[model samples]
Target: MRTTPAGGVVLVGVLAWISGVLQLFAGVLMLVAGDHPVTGWLHLLVGLATFPVCLAIFRARVWARIVLSVVFLFEIAAVVFALTDLRFLATPAVTSAVLAVFGLVLLYTPSANASFRQATIDRRNRAATAR
Candidate 1:
């Protein structure tokens, strides 16, 4: 399971973790401040999902790339929706949107993609050579 660590991925992972914690905290705050639970629950779910993803990214799991890519797209859509309603102008939402964009960009960069691909190729080659 050992894989070469990509610095960009590591940086992205840290940012993801930070954003997740922020979202989780915001969800709690919203829950306490509100009469409704649905919105808070959604934020909580999104936040909870992010912790595992951050770990996966750090480990350079191939699936991490796919999962993060999808999550990025989802968040972008969410941000757009929020912006349309003027709900995304708050400090935390704006910050999370920016961070998510940065993480997505880094993950999709050619260097990051090549590193992950190389890791996969090397692992297969090693396995085949061993056999």
Candidate 2:
């Protein structure tokens, strides 16, 4: 059976994709500017990795929720670190923190929880039927 995606999932997926693209652009720019090659490559790798997670989230995969939760937690921690250092928050950091909080809240909402649970059940049913 086909299931409709929760609004939260869609929102998170879109935001994640946008963030990933921006990260990829920043990585390329950093590389061209000849600064921090390691950081630039790391950013490139992260950007490329986000696509599959976004796709999984869009598909309502259970593992996607876990992955996203971990990612958001890291984003929040990074934001806190930046704040403690009294560093000016860049656009990406600010946006990431905001989106990370919003996404986490959405994911934990009652409707979103139900959607995820239902997706899990559907997947299990499908697997059982296939067997």
Candidate 3:
């Protein structure tokens, strides 16, 4: 069990935090536009949720990795579905697809896995010692 997280994990954590911030900003902008109230609120809730998930990822929590993996998978799936409409080269869709791929790759890298495993072991050890 290593004390330091892998570089990839740190990168993923930072990206996750950035994503959360962007979501929050976008949500605020949507609300200011005074339209799409449902979507705006949804973005706000998700943005709020992302902070804790990013924090957990930074702490190398395995559950966070799993949750992020699932989220990325859905992102990719949504992008693919959008592409089915034959708008294959839309900038936003393509960018999101690329980011999702990158995130999945980083989350599943060997070093990231090792970091998560080590963190879990460290946590269990701390709990045992506390008890």
Candidate 4:
């Protein structure tokens, strides 16, 4: 049976994708500007990784929620530090971090929780049917 995505899941997934796109752009900009190579590569890796995590989250995978929670938490802390500098207010990193935080919140909502549990049950049923 086909499943419809929950509203919270859709919201969080959109935020996650937006954050990933921002990260990808930041990575490119950093690399081209001869900025910190390590940081640039890290951004690229995170950007690339967010895509699959997003897909999993859309599917209501429990592990994806955990992974993204950690990522968003780190992003929030990073944004907090960056907020100390007024000049950094307009950066994409700040925007992405905000979006991540928003996504993190939605990820744990009641609707999202129900959706996740249902997905788990669906997966189990599918597996049983296949076997």
Candidate 5:
């Protein structure tokens, strides 16, 4: 496994922490409050749980990409569903949708791929040169 640079590590850490907090709050709201939340709290909980996956990405954990990708897909579906049902007008669904798409873009872009590869390669090269 390749180690991420300090800056990348910090970025992932902050993202993971913030996302986890948001997920937990959202999940609890859906599960424990309101007459009728748009969705189940379990989804929120799962999202929160998956927050660590984002952090793992910086560490180049293979599973992190797969998991985050799945989360983004789910967010896209949720956005589509909300828009179709006119729920977007009632809540922050549109904003959430936009954020998810942004994440998707980041994950799928060639730049991100190249960056990941470069990071990995650089780490290997540096390690080899050190020896």
Candidate 6:
């Protein structure tokens, strides 16, 4: 019998998806601005990458959880750097960092761990059965 997934992970996943969508929108805006092509492209790249991570997390993939943790780490770093000079953007930067932290914390809860572990086993079993 499969256990119900923890609510914390589900909330985190939804937040992550919302973040990814926001990034995609921001990337499009930057691209339209046509000031720094590289930055815009990087945003687009990260935003695009976030979708798969979001999907994997909902599916209880452990690696996706790890990847998201690392991503949030980078996000926190980015916000710190941005805060140094971009005072006008401080609100958004801090908000992003806080959400990242929240996601990271939820990703490590006991229920979240069990959900991911079970998913890993299920994935392995399916793979073996297919072979």
Best by lDDT: 4
* Model 5 poorest 10 in a row by lDDT: 84-93
Cα lDDT, model 2, residue 24: 63
TM-score of each: 0.80, 0.76, 0.69, 0.82, 0.60, 0.75
What's the residue-level lDDT of 4 in candidate 1?
A: 74
Can you tell me which runs of candidate 4 are displaced by over 4 Å? 77-90
lDDT of 4 at 18: 91
Give the Å error, residue 128, model 6. 2.6
Clashing pairs in 2: none
- Cα lDDT tens digits for candidate 2, 16-56: 77766655654565466533565556546666777789889
Instruction: Go through the candidates in order and give the clash count of each.
Output: 0, 0, 0, 0, 0, 0
Give residue 18's error in model 4 in angstroms: 0.8
TM-score head-to-head 1 vs 5, winner? 1
After superposition, the stretches of candidate 1 with alpha carbons farther than 4 Å from their true spots are: 79-89, 129-131
Candidate 4 per-residue C-alpha lDDT over 75-122 given as tens digits, one digit per residue, 9 for 90 to 100: 665444334432343287778887987898898889888898888899
Report residue 83 deviation for candidate 3 (angstroms): 12
Ranking by TM-score: 4, 1, 2, 6, 3, 5
**Largest TM-score belongs to which candidate?**
4
Error of 1 at 98 (Å): 1.0
Q: 2 or 6: which has the higher lDDT?
A: 2
- Candidates arranged by lDDT, highest first: 4, 1, 2, 6, 3, 5
Q: What value of lDDT does candidate 1 attain over all alpha carbons?
A: 0.71
Q: How far in Å is the alpha carbon of 122 misplaced in model 2?
A: 0.9
* Alpha-carbon deviation at 69 in model 6, angstroms: 0.7
